[model samples]
Target: MATEGSNSPLRFASVEASVPKITIQFCIQCKWNLRAAYYAQELLQTFSTSLGEVSLRPSTGGVFIVTLETFNQHSVLESHTIWDRKRDGGFPETKELKKKVRDIIDPQRDLGHVDGKKSATNPPAHPANAGHTRELKDVAAQVVDGPVKVSKLQDNRPESLGVQLVQAQNSSKSQDKAECEDCK
Candidate 1:
């Protein structure tokens, strides 16, 4: 029901209760724990045939109401359980360490070639590795320390990004619709 390019998704006038239902249940996991609940909300929003939104707070009962594309058609109501806290927690990343490291060398960036890449090469006390001291140090640092951790940001994985999720959701919807037609 969430057709793009709408001013506001219909949440009223019972506009979402009308979308037709398919045979297979859209979601498998029960909305129980925090993760499950969040996941359920994600799935519902992802798969909803009509405009949909989910809201849950610590103050009220932790349940998600899914208003399907029934807005135009049926005026239906569906509820699912949700989580109390987000599984991925921390803060908005105040700084990105990777960008910081990159900035030390390339104030302006490269031409997409490996050789054109600059390094935050440190000066050596004894210039044995002279020209490549910074490169050596950078490699050594990576080996000694590890990859930078995004401790502040929660669930910053590519799959978790909304753009990627929406792309995947669209592909999945097409496939599901195809499969349903094939079955009939």
Candidate 2:
């Protein structure tokens, strides 16, 4: 047994420096706790030194928000809505989530291939978009290389046209579902 004043090895308690905190509020009703926790773990692991804590808060409704706060001050510095079932209709991609968090925590950080522009420019030879990526690249090249003339419509704007198209597609999908159900 070591005595009180024995010549034993001196041991020092490890002290961890506190950094900023990140809070992820996930909706319990929407069953997004696992998704939120996974994101929290990813963020914590990525920014271990820069982050002090990552907390998860269960909320009602369909809210999936990520908030960054100061550890010592306990004040929220920035917040981002990672997902909103009612508003966005679906969950965000992992890359998108990482980009949002990176923007808040470390603005200048590079996410390599996860960045949209980089991936868009150097698209993989996969059937992910069914060659739509090439078409988009061509359109983008055309737009950048020359002055594109926009034909103005008398009663419709581009934004309104997009909204109308989306509404039409949604209505058609609902009709298709109804027709399928009738057939069954």
Best model per TM-score? 2
Worst 10 residues of 2 by lDDT: 163-172
Instruction: State every prediction's TM-score relative to the real structure.
Output: 0.17, 0.44
**lDDT on C-alpha atoms for all candidate structures:** 0.31, 0.61
* Model 1: residues with Cα > 4 Å off, grouped in runs: 1-33, 48-50, 57-69, 72-184
Question: For candidate 1, lDDT tens digit of each residue in 1-184?
Answer: 4568878776645443323221112222222246435534543443353223433222222322221222222543432211112222321121221122123323353322233455567453666434344644554454456543222112333322222111111123343332322123
User: Which one wins on lDDT?
Assistant: 2
Q: Candidate 1's C-alpha lDDT?
A: 0.31
lDDT of 1 at 128: 47
